[model samples]
Target: MTMRTRARTMTALLALAAMTGLAGCAPGPIVEDGPGEAGTLEVQKVNPADFAGQSLSYVYFTDGPDEAATRELIASFEEEYDVTVNLEVLPYSDLVTSVQARLSGGNAPDVVRLTGLTDFRADLLDLRTYLGEDYAEEFVDGPVKGVLGEYGEMLAVPSDLTLNGPFINVDLFNEAGVPLPDSEDPWTWDEMIDAATKVQEATDTEYAFAIDKSGHRVSTVLSQYGTALVGDDGAVLDEAKAVEALQPLVDMMADGRMPRDFWLGSGSRYEGANDIFLAQQTPVYLSGNWQVGQFADNADFTWAAAPNPCADECGGFPGGKYMGALAEGPNPALGAFFVQYMNTTKAQQKFIVAGGFLPTRVDLTERGVQYPVRQEDMDVFFADLARTPDLGYEANSQPSYTGASLELVDELALVVAGEKDTTTAVSDLKAKSEQLVEELQP
Candidate 1:
């Protein structure tokens, strides 16, 4: 209700209050915190009045997170800014293509959405120019890089370094009589394949591995080799390195270790065959973090997170999501604000609670938020994310690199499809990828 009333609940000085209203439900109370929690929520401080009477259009990944509270917060911003904030959602695949077309056609949303690694690096306005001096550290580490151009300049503020990974059906493993690994003993590649093969042999499954040959899935395999899809030279992965990089995975398929057709083919239901896993037809799902919300909602079997299996030599893959800001928008400030807003500790709490996205902020992960109903579930994801090396980020593993890295994926498809031998595929991929990387390199 009243700000003063909200203040009574906080321990000390109250800088911000988040009031939520659910549809067809009574307006919920505000959650207020003392100083530094939300980094100055006082409307007077940021001057929501500055945004009044204006409409801000943000082009985002067509749709994500409709948590009533976030919408309520947007409404409050609208009321404060006196402007309508229109969110344009697009498919993850097409978000960039859409942004580029709009910018060229001059119909671009004021705010643009970018993957951590997929979108253009130089096209955005320099956020550091807007948030320079001392205000920058208030943001997370990943967003700080958004300003960094190809040679390293801050092009835009970061949205989120969303974590994506393998989803395991532990109950299915148990049911199929495959031994599940302990929390300490993460599965190795051979072990993962063996377990999947065993599950198929022991059950009436159509597929063992939840084949996803997308570059997203390949990141994990690349990581398993301690090889980043984009190398230190910042060129397309050496097709040789790319091939050698993904050798273990190709071998797994070649040896009849995992399902044959599912990954190498693009026709699978993109929403996930998690249903297959749910129905006990496919036991594992190699998917993004967003699927957690979907999984908890539909899964009937008792599933658990297994440390993503890795190559025998290297450890697990370091997962970094793609996110970015638009070059132009109806509300550049607010678009920037949303980028900041979504990546904040507060939003991360909601992510863990709502979508199971891993927090990129080390501080948040170490001192986790209490937003999720399933703390245990959050804890497991947090651990899964923590095991990843910081080197992945330093290696420039932003989701933005998805396109350039995909040259290798195209080659992998040929390998698995029997169109090309693994050796030739890797060798050819290395050459083509090197050229692409040279073109994309900073």
Candidate 2:
């Protein structure tokens, strides 16, 4: 399709057209407008003729609607710039390690779509120099901080931002004659369970609650309790708050409000309770926004996204996929330019719609990308993302966090299995995390 034709098609796909903002990454504080407002941010333009005939290699992993959107964007880039972007797709499990190995071996691809930014920091191309300082400033500070190097270089442009939140079976709540909590007035952990219990019992559901078996998902509870695996000092978890977080999970499992088999059923390998939620066996599922597309596509029953329950505060863990160029890539100019190209206002709008993702750019966050489906669910997720505490980003940004988080899952599994008490688990986790942070220090 011609560029004009394609742009028109994308516009037709959304109920609203995102307003074009001031060009060249205008410097200013983001005006806090609701997502309903039109976005007013534009990407700093790149000269299509600058890298004409240049060839670049991009290593990527394909999943969800993003893969198609990426390929479409790339096709446009190749046509406009006369650049040949050789795309190589890999399995998500191996993408990071494979790219790291290539970087370590001094044979990195020109660009890569990465989830593990801190792991590839040394080899990541700093786009700030190429894309301009104002361009980097347009992104949300929290997600940007997660991908930046210690020297504050922009390692990647964050995309497809993901946040953890709660999903409920609306039918179950109605059947139980219980009212759902207002989004403005969120429920505490106990209050949420109390409501879920009533719903479960009234509807004859097997469980009141089910959370995905992920350290990342459980961290939402930690965040709600005002604690994180990584604190101001590296590898420090607040023991009292950490115990407070685990106690609820422990109590629910003991009382059968939550299914013990699901938590204990999956050993150390990551698992999710989405299936149970889909089967309508549970009244509530504490998962993330990534499930929205799947649920919208296949769910036979009515469901809705709800405000996350609170403890010390209400929030979810912040994380997202990122696009970056390699410092060692053969075509640094073209690679960096392509990275900048992906974050353009038009590109971001197309990406989120295709992938059912939340936008990472501040302008898009304010302007809002209207999904062709599930607009309300996306709104709840956007609000939950706003509630994410600074520590959520900080914890994920730590290089050691990946290893520490894996160990965290194992430790928490022990706590649920009665192999270790919360106090002991917290202590062991702190010690192990410290070791990991030291080992991963650059």
Residue by residue across 25-68, what tens digits does model 1's lDDT show?
22222111221122222121233335546676766552355345
Among these predictions, the greatest lDDT belongs to 2
Work out the TM-score per prediction: 0.76, 0.88
Residue ranges of candidate 2 with Cα displaced over 4 Å: 1-47
Report the Cα RMSD per candidate: 9.7, 7.9
Please write out the lDDT profile of model 2 over residues 286-370, one tens digit for every residue: 9988899999988999999999998888878877888998878898768887887788888988988888888888899988779
- Give the TM-score comparing model 2 with the true structure, all chains together: 0.88
Residue 422, candidate 1: C-alpha displacement in angstroms: 1.8
**Model 2 lDDT, full chain set:** 0.80
Error of 2 at 419 (Å): 1.2
Reference-based lDDT, residue 36, model 2: 20
